[model samples]
Target: MATTGESTDTAARTGEQYLAGLSVGEREIWLKGEKVTSPLDSPELRSAALSMARVFDLQHEHADEMLAPSPDDGRLVNVTHLIPRSREDLERRRRAIELTAALSGGMMGRTPDYLNVTFACFSGRSDVWARRGNEEGAANIVAYQKLMRDGDLSTTHALMNPQVDRTKPEAEQMMGEVSLHKVGENDDSIILRGARMLATLAPFADDLLVYPGSDIRPQDGRYALAFAIPIATPGLRFICRDSFSKQRNTFDYPLSSRFDEMDCVVIFDDVEVPRERLFLDGDTVGYSEVITDTGWRGHIMHQAFTRAYVKLAFAFGLGHMIAEVTAVNRFDHVQEKIGQIWNMMELTRAAIVAAEAGSFEDAGGVWYPDERPFVALRGEMPKWIPRANELLQLIGGGGFMATPSKADIEGPLGPEIEKYFQSAGADATRRIRLFRLAWDYLGSDLGGRGELYERFYLSDSYRMTALAYTIADKAFPASLVEQFLED
Candidate 1:
């Protein structure tokens, strides 16, 4: 509920301005082995890019809820970039994150706001970087936070090492087979080479952050680095996976047609990261500490939980609608299936609310949402998402496969198709539209990709469970139970 000082005075741009910025960039991107001149060149990529731009436009309209006054200047900036020092600030950020997730129907995973919170976390604990005797690195973190906040820049990240042979250690693997590393550094910049996997939304973003993933050993020093660079940086190329947004008819593939954020393998063929952009270099302890000790993980998890909640709500609503159109809402078994989805939705909603309600301040005076609910949400979502999709498929029955195409609805068979496809309460067109949407969400390639994304979005399941257990152990120490036991 914090409005901008003036529409013209705000730092954020409208959706059109964001699109124009992307159109002029000379970034390298490839899909299906061909070089793409720009994301706008492909209809699918362009739709995804436009969908992202709408997030910025939403910020402009709801500036009071989304924007907060910058510390250095009076210009209103995004709440995502706010470094929360009080409980109210945390609540404000939670509201902003919810609004953005709702705008995209919780499908746009690498929205600019995600990284905004990352930089905000770094800025809050800038001294952690300073402790490495890299004062410049500390300054860079603060400056980059201001730069992105004031400019409203969109960013994606490539944190995972390239998935090659997991048996070999990163240090032992061949240079190209391992993750990105610094091969050379000059007085002004460092030259990076090698590749990083699964840079989601890289082609559509304004910048990319290259950072260390978890469990990095000290021997992997060359690969332990953190920095940000423009997407158009020379030698920085994105080799993309197939685009799911390629659907021409929005009605047939409603969600995929607009929300397919193309995932890619970001290749850095000697890309130059200027000294000013470097946040960490060869400091394995510092690199690991920055994420674990700075409350950054909690902040990022907060955004993820909020987004997942919206997605669950969307899925639940779709299931309910499907039951109505199919006239199966009356059946006891069908109602029970719907009830299962409803229960998951309610649980997710409770996690989001509880996380915020139990928010507490960290050692640095930054208020973070309670980690327990977030960790639980992360652990449960992988299972719940697939089950929810299965429920939709079950309720849909053969209708998911038998739905008519857009062309069929408008051609010679239109009348016959309509007469036969009409359901109890809905006409043929209405029934077809609903089924098509459900198919796109549950049966299409897009839906398949989403299931995979949700399953591993936070990382491997066993690792996540271990992490949750570790947190719980510390919060409720095992020694407490020993005192009550009889010897």
Candidate 2:
């Protein structure tokens, strides 16, 4: 592993390079009640590992769009690591994000670019992490960003505290160490114990980024912490959910096989965080300000919303294909269902465009998309994908259930499948393949997880709506209504 200020080859990494890095260290990944020695060694995780490698390969294949010239050296790096200084830079970054998202049809949400954009924003506003006299921590952020950028490392973040009891704050819970908190400090590092929830991509990621998830009260300073560390660090373990990638056949489980991108509960049992790797400490006020103070919300949403737009577009195309193959598009209700998905795609695209058009450079000289549209979109976004999935179910109707498995189609039932499954627009083979994809995306376990992830990935939708209304500037619009009433 590279030290705090270590340098590496400046060129962007390839898929092979990424796969080789996973074997350099041992990560404690627990899946299906067993300790997985490595991602490549586990059947459930290998598909996602290869899928991510393909993403890296695609970046190189389309280097003109995804790779950018590093600011420090003239070497090429992923565009997600590029700090945007102008709208043109933001557009270039958007192209990279959109291309990556399209590769998985937006099924893999935590692709490496997600955190790459995050650290770029954090490093650009390195001053904010220095608040409360933590200059050393701020410098660490800059060095870490360059380290990851130069190496093209993949990182996963765990921000949400474990849900031991929802009624009380973490500090007030019956268990004192229920959530990840500081226990002691040595001359050179801090000792941490407890765990964080929902670290997607933990098994395959090179590093883990931990930060304050919710607002920490001043009295709960012990619970406030932030840092970056390798996933293989001693005393760190990741317990993942059941594997959704149960089937290896692409025809049977198209999305799940390649895009599970597993989520896990990250446990840090007496883990030691080196001083240089610690970016935020016991400063509660500073911890509360990290996301906004660094303009990370707007910057990350650039990648998120772009992925969302691609997902909705995929949903739209699938819905249309299903309707066309089954001859349902001739009906009014089917057309309306298809149009609903199109509307969602257009709305997301409009939000992305509006946010970029309203982009502004912050006081730290870092550019960010306008967050107002993103905030509004978040309130509506939690429902868009699920609703699209529901519409797909309605559009496909009985066809989803009647579809034959890849094996059944190639077995003794082959002649029956061809004779009975033919549709108005497609032959039996094409129709089965198309409908199977729809089912994999709409009815499978991976599809359910995708819906749940969208609903809560950015936090509770109701709370987001409340916060949006609370922080929104409404005086001018209210005044306009008041003047009309007076007249």
Q: CA lDDT, every prediction?
A: 0.84, 0.89
Candidate number with greatest lDDT: 2
Error of 1 at 21 (Å): 1.3
Write one digit per residue (lDDT tens) for candidate 2, span 176-265: 677889999999999999988889999889999987667878988888898999989999999999999855588877888899999999
Residues 1-487, candidate 1: write the lDDT tens digits: 3245534468887888888878666889998878886788876688988888888899988988988777776678889898887768877887888899887677777788888888898888888887769788889988998898898898899988776877776776775445788899999999999888888988888889876567578777888789999999899999999888855778777888888888999999998999999998988898888878888778888888778888888788888998998889999999999999899888877887787788888877778888788888788888888999999989989988768888899999999998999999699998888888887776788889888988997896677888888777463465677667857
Pairing residues by index, what is the TM-score of model 2? Answer: 0.97
lDDT of 2 at 485: 91
TM-score of each: 0.95, 0.97
Show the colliding residue pairs in model 2: none
